[model samples]
Target: MPDNVPMEQAAILADAVSTPFGAVVHTEVRVGESVGVRGAGGVGTHVVQIARLVGATPVIVMDVNDEVLQRSLDLGADHAFRSDDPALQAKVAEKPYLNRT
Candidate 1:
């Protein structure tokens, strides 16, 4: 957040720093590609947003927690599932390209 921005919104700086340096810089995520983030933790959550911003479709996010999985869906993931769920493999298989990292 800028010096003049609200202090409450300072959390935005997390992704503001990670999005460009981590996702966009190190990865070769292309448009129309599918992305599957294995965890919905801090970094993984940001990856979900970055993937969507770059035009990734059917963005998938997998985690052990139901709330986190749902949160990923709310954050732009097309599919969110528990990592241990047997159905996860089948769902991932359905995507044309899944950039799981």
Candidate 2:
């Protein structure tokens, strides 16, 4: 996560799409670490930043667009890849903080 990134948008999207009853998007891991989270849209750009605030170092972002991938890298992703990659799950798994769900 980059410094000064806000998480409000991700909080809204996660609740709108997956969580019930307007939940808090932030999650704390059992291992006492916060995971890098990429928002599905433009909002995702912020998720990576906020993840850093919560303690994920060297944030990684996920996107299908090449430009967005580049922007994400510019925003401070230590590394990044397309969500559409054939080996997407494998690549994600390579990150210590992000394994296949």
Candidate 3:
């Protein structure tokens, strides 16, 4: 644990960040790569930040909740979409930046 982090917050912080950090590391996300996270809850939110921290570009988030989607954007996601949208796939496909050849 870092000296800057308060002890009271350590466990919660680790629990929140560990899985996402591991997942991002395990996937070997490269700089400038586009990342799409499929949820916007606790773990998903952390994934967005970790991806961004590792230099992933155009980090996109998908979730059913409008508030959660917006929150993802605020947290570091370049784009957010409602998973329940019937046009979600089309919308994502239309984003030219996401379709790197």
Candidate 4:
């Protein structure tokens, strides 16, 4: 936070940082596609929830457990797949390529 910002908001910003293994529940932490934070678990669940909140379309959640796969879909994921699934790639790429200027 800038020096001109309110102390309360600065305190809120200060609360955002945490170590992964040391994170406490009910506290928000940043975890955007980092090295060890790929697959869905505790922190990963928070990732999914935030992604859903922000309207990430065609959210493909990959996991081996049937129950967890189902849970991903129920949690607003557009699709879920096992790692070795034959159709996973195709299913994820249903739409044609888009040109970026």
Candidate 5:
């Protein structure tokens, strides 16, 4: 852990940081790439930040909660939407790199 970081924060960092960091590294996320996170809870929130940290463009995050979706935007996501939005599929389809599945 870095000396500047608080121990309490550092302790949870491993849990909150590892998965997203590993996924970004292993996926070889390149600059200008697009990233989509399906959930906006603990893990999903970190994924948004990690994707932006790695220079991903149009980081889209989806969740059922409006507040969580907004939080994703506050963090780093370029787009936020409810999972059950009537136009969700259409909106996603319009994005060039967003995988359907």
Candidate 6:
């Protein structure tokens, strides 16, 4: 209900902003933590942005589409991978963030 956002756009905007933020809040994500999001679609993209904004480092995004993976990186994910990759687990484990004792 902001002065700038038209009423017609309000619902969509609210959904776009709230869903990801709510998920982040519910999960209690902390600064410098590694975040791995499984999807890079509409709401998943926003999750990447929100995770980065909250200071999560090495934000990893996984999706089946190469384009989506790239988009996640562009949106501030530290790493992107195809969810269907046979080596997905190994690849994710290789990140330095997850190696910490």
Best by TM-score: 6
**Candidate 5: which pairs clash?**
none
Model 3 residue pairs with clashes = none
Clashing pairs in 1: none
Q: For each candidate, what is the lDDT?
A: 0.79, 0.57, 0.92, 0.52, 0.90, 0.90
lDDT of 5 by residue, 49-101 (tens): 99999999989988999999999999999999899999998988887776566
Please give, for residues 1-101, the per-residue lDDT of candidate 1 as tens digits: 46998876676666654663377447788888777788988778888888888888878888999999999999999988889988877877766565455
Per-residue accuracy of model 4 over 23-77 as CA lDDT, tens digit each: 3223433333212123555544444555655444545577667777777678766
Q: State the local distance difference test value for candidate 2.
A: 0.57
Residue 5 of model 6, lDDT score: 87
Of 1 and 4, the candidate ahead on TM-score is 1
Query: Residue 17 CA error for candidate 2 (Å)?
Result: 17
- Candidate with better TM-score, 3 vs 6: 6
Error of 6 at 79 (Å): 0.2
Best by lDDT: 3
Count of clashing pairs, candidate 3: 0
Stretches of candidate 1 above 4 Å error? 1-21, 94-101
Q: What's each prediction's TM-score?
A: 0.71, 0.53, 0.85, 0.50, 0.81, 0.86
Off by over 4 Å in 4: 1-38, 95-101
Give the clash count for each candidate: 0, 1, 0, 0, 0, 0
Model 6, residue 15: distance off in Å is 2.8
Can you give the lDDT of residue 100 in candidate 1? Answer: 57
lDDT minimum window of 10 residues, candidate 6: 92-101
Decoy 4 TM-score against native: 0.50
Give a tens-digit lDDT track for model 3, residues 1-96.
889988878886776789899989999999999899998798899999999999999899999999999999998999999999999999999998
Model 3 misplacement above 4 A: 1-11
Deviation of model 5 at 57, angstroms: 0.6
